[model samples]
Target: MMARTKGTANKASSQNENVVTLENPIKRGDTLIETITLIKPNAGTLRGVSLQDVATSDVNALIKVLPRMTYPSLTEHEVVNLELPDMIALAGQVIGFLSPTSVC
Candidate 1:
Protein backbone atom coordinates (compact mmCIF):
# COMPACT_ATOMS: atom_id res chain seq x y z
CA MET A 1 0.00 0.00 0.00
CA MET A 2 1.24 3.52 -0.81
CA ALA A 3 0.69 6.73 1.17
CA ARG A 4 -0.90 9.69 -0.61
CA THR A 5 1.70 12.32 -1.45
CA LYS A 6 1.06 16.06 -0.88
CA GLY A 7 1.41 16.67 -4.62
CA THR A 8 -1.22 14.02 -5.35
CA ALA A 9 -3.66 15.63 -2.90
CA ASN A 10 -3.00 19.06 -4.40
CA LYS A 11 -3.61 17.81 -7.93
CA ALA A 12 -6.85 16.10 -6.93
CA SER A 13 -8.13 19.22 -5.19
CA SER A 14 -7.09 21.50 -8.03
CA GLN A 15 -9.50 19.94 -10.48
CA ASN A 16 -12.96 20.15 -9.05
CA GLU A 17 -15.25 18.34 -11.48
CA ASN A 18 -18.39 19.59 -9.75
CA VAL A 19 -17.86 23.34 -10.06
CA VAL A 20 -20.11 24.95 -12.66
CA THR A 21 -19.02 28.28 -14.10
CA LEU A 22 -22.27 29.93 -15.11
CA GLU A 23 -22.68 31.08 -18.71
CA ASN A 24 -24.96 33.77 -17.35
CA PRO A 25 -24.44 34.54 -13.72
CA ILE A 26 -27.42 34.70 -11.40
CA LYS A 27 -27.97 37.24 -8.62
CA ARG A 28 -29.05 36.37 -5.12
CA GLY A 29 -29.91 39.55 -3.19
CA ASP A 30 -26.87 41.75 -3.88
CA THR A 31 -24.57 38.81 -4.57
CA LEU A 32 -23.74 37.95 -8.16
CA ILE A 33 -22.80 34.28 -8.37
CA GLU A 34 -20.20 33.36 -10.98
CA THR A 35 -19.60 29.69 -10.17
CA ILE A 36 -21.47 26.98 -8.32
CA THR A 37 -19.76 24.04 -6.63
CA LEU A 38 -21.72 20.90 -5.95
CA ILE A 39 -20.61 18.40 -3.35
CA LYS A 40 -21.07 14.67 -3.92
CA PRO A 41 -24.36 13.71 -2.35
CA ASN A 42 -24.94 11.15 0.35
CA ALA A 43 -28.17 9.22 1.05
CA GLY A 44 -29.40 12.07 3.24
CA THR A 45 -28.79 14.56 0.45
CA LEU A 46 -31.06 12.46 -1.78
CA ARG A 47 -33.92 12.62 0.69
CA GLY A 48 -37.32 13.01 -1.01
CA VAL A 49 -35.61 12.80 -4.40
CA SER A 50 -35.60 9.83 -6.75
CA LEU A 51 -32.16 8.45 -7.67
CA GLN A 52 -33.45 7.15 -11.01
CA ASP A 53 -34.71 10.59 -11.95
CA VAL A 54 -31.40 12.24 -11.00
CA ALA A 55 -29.42 9.53 -12.84
CA THR A 56 -31.58 10.34 -15.86
CA SER A 57 -30.89 14.10 -15.41
CA ASP A 58 -34.51 14.85 -14.76
CA VAL A 59 -34.90 18.63 -14.24
CA ASN A 60 -37.44 18.43 -11.46
CA ALA A 61 -35.40 15.86 -9.58
CA LEU A 62 -32.26 17.96 -9.97
CA ILE A 63 -34.04 21.08 -8.81
CA LYS A 64 -35.04 19.25 -5.67
CA VAL A 65 -31.62 17.78 -4.98
CA LEU A 66 -29.21 20.52 -6.12
CA PRO A 67 -29.67 22.92 -3.27
CA ARG A 68 -28.69 20.20 -0.87
CA MET A 69 -25.46 19.44 -2.73
CA THR A 70 -24.51 22.95 -3.81
CA TYR A 71 -22.21 25.44 -2.09
CA PRO A 72 -23.20 29.06 -1.41
CA SER A 73 -26.59 27.45 -0.73
CA LEU A 74 -29.10 28.22 -3.44
CA THR A 75 -32.71 29.15 -3.06
CA GLU A 76 -35.49 27.52 -5.07
CA HIS A 77 -35.82 30.78 -6.99
CA GLU A 78 -32.11 30.77 -7.80
CA VAL A 79 -32.18 27.18 -9.02
CA VAL A 80 -35.24 27.88 -11.16
CA ASN A 81 -33.56 30.96 -12.59
CA LEU A 82 -30.48 29.15 -13.96
CA GLU A 83 -29.96 29.78 -17.68
CA LEU A 84 -30.55 26.88 -20.06
CA PRO A 85 -26.88 26.24 -20.85
CA ASP A 86 -25.89 26.56 -17.21
CA MET A 87 -28.66 24.17 -16.24
CA ILE A 88 -27.50 21.66 -18.83
CA ALA A 89 -23.91 21.85 -17.60
CA LEU A 90 -25.06 21.45 -14.02
CA ALA A 91 -27.21 18.48 -15.01
CA GLY A 92 -24.21 16.85 -16.63
CA GLN A 93 -22.14 17.31 -13.46
CA VAL A 94 -24.94 15.80 -11.38
CA ILE A 95 -25.05 12.78 -13.66
CA GLY A 96 -21.28 12.43 -13.41
CA PHE A 97 -21.53 12.31 -9.62
CA LEU A 98 -23.95 9.41 -9.85
CA SER A 99 -21.97 7.48 -12.44
CA PRO A 100 -19.36 4.85 -11.57
CA THR A 101 -15.73 5.75 -12.17
CA SER A 102 -13.31 3.31 -13.90
CA VAL A 103 -11.50 0.98 -11.50
CA CYS A 104 -8.08 1.64 -12.88
Candidate 2:
Protein backbone atom coordinates (compact mmCIF):
# COMPACT_ATOMS: atom_id res chain seq x y z
CA MET A 1 0.00 0.00 0.00
CA MET A 2 1.14 3.54 -0.80
CA ALA A 3 0.57 6.70 1.22
CA ARG A 4 0.43 10.35 0.27
CA THR A 5 0.02 13.54 2.28
CA LYS A 6 -2.54 16.23 1.60
CA GLY A 7 -2.98 19.44 3.58
CA THR A 8 -5.88 21.73 4.37
CA ALA A 9 -5.83 24.97 6.34
CA ASN A 10 -8.11 25.26 9.34
CA LYS A 11 -9.23 28.69 10.53
CA ALA A 12 -7.83 28.01 14.00
CA SER A 13 -4.30 27.47 12.70
CA SER A 14 -2.26 28.93 9.88
CA GLN A 15 -0.25 25.68 9.77
CA ASN A 16 -1.69 23.17 7.31
CA GLU A 17 -3.17 20.02 8.78
CA ASN A 18 -1.57 17.00 7.14
CA VAL A 19 -3.95 14.36 5.83
CA VAL A 20 -2.56 10.98 5.06
CA THR A 21 -4.22 8.86 2.39
CA LEU A 22 -3.66 5.15 2.49
CA GLU A 23 -4.31 2.89 -0.51
CA ASN A 24 -7.32 0.68 0.06
CA PRO A 25 -6.56 -2.99 0.45
CA ILE A 26 -9.88 -4.29 -0.85
CA LYS A 27 -10.79 -3.90 -4.49
CA ARG A 28 -13.62 -4.77 -6.86
CA GLY A 29 -12.11 -5.71 -10.20
CA ASP A 30 -9.79 -2.96 -11.49
CA THR A 31 -11.66 0.02 -10.05
CA LEU A 32 -11.31 1.39 -6.55
CA ILE A 33 -14.77 1.66 -4.97
CA GLU A 34 -14.11 4.80 -2.91
CA THR A 35 -11.78 6.67 -0.64
CA ILE A 36 -12.35 7.55 3.03
CA THR A 37 -10.76 10.27 5.12
CA LEU A 38 -9.36 9.47 8.54
CA ILE A 39 -8.97 12.24 11.07
CA LYS A 40 -7.06 12.13 14.33
CA PRO A 41 -9.37 12.93 17.22
CA ASN A 42 -8.43 16.01 19.17
CA ALA A 43 -8.25 14.84 22.80
CA GLY A 44 -9.68 18.10 24.10
CA THR A 45 -12.94 17.33 22.30
CA LEU A 46 -13.88 14.74 24.93
CA ARG A 47 -15.08 17.14 27.60
CA GLY A 48 -17.09 14.89 29.90
CA VAL A 49 -17.21 11.58 28.09
CA SER A 50 -14.42 9.12 28.62
CA LEU A 51 -12.98 7.10 25.75
CA GLN A 52 -14.84 4.06 27.10
CA ASP A 53 -18.12 5.97 27.01
CA VAL A 54 -17.54 6.96 23.44
CA ALA A 55 -16.65 3.39 22.46
CA THR A 56 -19.65 1.85 24.20
CA SER A 57 -22.24 4.21 22.75
CA ASP A 58 -24.64 2.95 20.05
CA VAL A 59 -22.49 2.34 17.01
CA ASN A 60 -25.55 1.90 14.84
CA ALA A 61 -26.27 5.60 15.25
CA LEU A 62 -22.74 6.40 14.21
CA ILE A 63 -23.06 4.05 11.26
CA LYS A 64 -26.22 5.86 10.18
CA VAL A 65 -25.08 9.41 10.88
CA LEU A 66 -21.51 9.21 9.60
CA PRO A 67 -22.38 8.66 5.96
CA ARG A 68 -24.68 11.63 6.07
CA MET A 69 -21.93 13.75 7.62
CA THR A 70 -19.11 12.69 5.31
CA TYR A 71 -19.68 10.30 2.45
CA PRO A 72 -23.27 10.62 1.32
CA SER A 73 -22.51 9.29 -2.15
CA LEU A 74 -21.19 5.96 -0.85
CA THR A 75 -23.71 3.23 -0.10
CA GLU A 76 -23.90 1.17 3.12
CA HIS A 77 -21.87 -1.67 1.63
CA GLU A 78 -19.08 0.78 0.85
CA VAL A 79 -18.58 1.47 4.56
CA VAL A 80 -17.79 -2.11 5.53
CA ASN A 81 -14.47 -1.17 7.10
CA LEU A 82 -16.07 1.06 9.73
CA GLU A 83 -16.36 -1.02 12.88
CA LEU A 84 -17.08 0.04 16.48
CA PRO A 85 -13.66 1.52 17.23
CA ASP A 86 -13.59 3.28 13.89
CA MET A 87 -17.01 4.76 14.54
CA ILE A 88 -15.96 6.00 17.97
CA ALA A 89 -12.87 7.65 16.57
CA LEU A 90 -14.90 9.19 13.77
CA ALA A 91 -17.40 10.50 16.30
CA GLY A 92 -14.63 12.16 18.29
CA GLN A 93 -13.17 13.67 15.12
CA VAL A 94 -16.59 14.95 14.09
CA ILE A 95 -17.26 16.41 17.50
CA GLY A 96 -13.99 18.26 17.22
CA PHE A 97 -14.84 19.49 13.74
CA LEU A 98 -18.33 20.72 14.59
CA SER A 99 -17.28 22.49 17.77
CA PRO A 100 -13.59 23.21 17.58
CA THR A 101 -13.68 25.22 20.82
CA SER A 102 -15.09 22.41 22.93
CA VAL A 103 -17.48 19.44 22.76
CA CYS A 104 -19.49 20.67 25.75
Tens-digit lDDT track for model 2 on 1-104? 53422234332233532221223422444544333343434444344445454455445444544444442233445445654444444455554554436466
Best by TM-score: 1
Check candidate 1 and list the clashing pairs.
none
RMSD of 2: 8.8
| CA lDDT, every model vs. true structure | 0.76, 0.42
Model 1, 1-20: lDDT tens digits are 33311111121235775677
Per-candidate TM-scores read 0.82, 0.39
Evaluated at residue 49, the lDDT of candidate 2 is 43
Off by over 4 Å in 2: 1-29, 33-57, 80-85, 98-104
